[model samples]
Target: MLAIAEYVVRGALSGAIYALLAVPMSLMFVTVRTIDFAVGAYALIAAAVCWSVGGALGLAAGLGAAMACAAFMAIIFLALKRLGCEDHIIYALASFGLATALASLVLWWWGTQAFVRDAFSDPWSVGGIRLAPQGVINFALILLLVGALHLLIQHTSLGRMMRAAAANQTGAALASIPVQGIQVGTYLAGGLLGGLAGLLVLYSAGLDFTAPLGLTLSGFGAAIIFGIGSPLRGFFGGLAMGIAQALAAGYASAMVAGMVPFLFVLLVLTTSRFGEEALAGGRP
Candidate 1:
């Protein structure tokens, strides 16, 4: 049916945005073996800064905020390393607290007001389907960036060093790889991706203090479903999540739609061994 086609298209667009947001988290997890619970806050603060300043200046401000947030996370990670803490749960606890604190700070600074910015104000029509220009731009730009990042990781010397460090920090150090530097670089790269996603989210939806958590959840779920080991899979997972959520909203209820992403994740976890193996970064 035409309705089904429409849902699929719209969902895919939204899903692409989610994929972008998820990529940073996935990148961190896969490369650094770290989870930045504050990934969403980076996006929120960037968007807020962009809206407050407006124009190109606002965009720069937004990105800067994201970088700053990433720096803060990197500092935390560095501190943990200094203390000889390599346990992931410890990092998770620290990241959770960091996320909460950063979110609170953003709220204190920006207040709870939602911002609506004009983005891709044009709509493109294709064979009776209406699509927002911003949405298309979001999808295209994100994929391009993701692809570039992928190439950097797959083909570059720095990327190989990072991957080597990720696979075994001690071994990497023994192999003459700069493990500490690689860790810092990974965190910074993750932050950059997070900031970029935030800018895109601002264009897609009005920026809000609470936007980060939802974005984080969507991205986290997508990454988990697709296997954090494979960034490409994370992108596809987000697309699938978006399509399912769209269908749920169109055919069921808005509340149900909101729950659809997690439900789909649950379904994947229960029925698909691939999801688990992928989470573990093993071949499916």
Candidate 2:
């Protein structure tokens, strides 16, 4: 029981990073009706850059690289829009292509080396359960950032604009809202959040060049597990996924542990009305 408790605690902390990654997915889905499949690529690039450079400047450089990649995605998005591409699947595919390209770029540039960094030398004891200081920091930072995002989405005029744009892009455009600009901003925000998640992961479990697709799928699972309608839901979903995976890792095979997120996604899609709504083009 004690061991299980520890797993749960650790899982929650790790899940916070997934929640951060999911935020951009939720925001972009709501605003643009598409998934930014390149989000994980953004994280991977950030980690790769940070690993190569090392130190505080590496962090900045990593984030900059991630955001630059996002800017490139934004340009692709805008170009697609300009070309009169209205299919959300096309957007998703485009992002997937970008993700693949970025992964290849990382592999070509950095090889298959794993990106990792140790931020703390000791674990902190909290309520008799040992926890990594870095994990605690990650959890706290996620809480604050998620809270801020909730506030931004629910209270501010910018949030209102985002919601308006999501609810009806045509109407928002008629209302003189810069829908494209808002979408571009959302992409940039995705980059920031994805890059931050990469840094957190680098300092936690580490990852390799092959991690981008897995990371993207994990974030997507987290985003949709509780319905991608809100960031708060995505936050909880991430925690749920983390806990499930942690429990599996503790008691089951490693392969089973890895399959947890995908299983959750499958379960959600089969049992929830959210999947139906998404397919029918209804707002989640």
**Estimated TM-score for each candidate:** 0.94, 0.94
Error of 2 at 29 (Å): 0.9
* Cα lDDT, model 1, residue 177: 95
For residue 119, give model 2's deviation from the true position in Å: 1.3
Q: Roughly what TM-score does model 2 have, to 2 decimal places?
A: 0.94
lDDT of 1 at 125: 94
Q: Candidate 1 on 1-284: residue-level lDDT in tens?
A: 98899999999999997788778776777667877777887888788888889999999998998888888888988898789998977876776787777778878987888866876666899778899888888889878877887787778898778777778888999999988877777777767778778888788776777777788888888887867766787888889899998899899876576777678888896679767786566521
RMSD in Å for all candidates: 1.7, 1.8
lDDT per residue for candidate 2 within 1-284, as digits (tens), equals 89999999988998888888889998998788889999999999999999899999999999999999999999999999999998989989999999999999999999988999999999999989989899999999999999999899988989888988988999999999999999999999999999989999999989999999989988888888777867887898789888888888898887677776667667876788866553454543
Model 2: runs farther than 4 Å from truth? 253-255, 272-284
> What lDDT does each candidate get?
0.80, 0.89
The collision pairs in model 2 are none
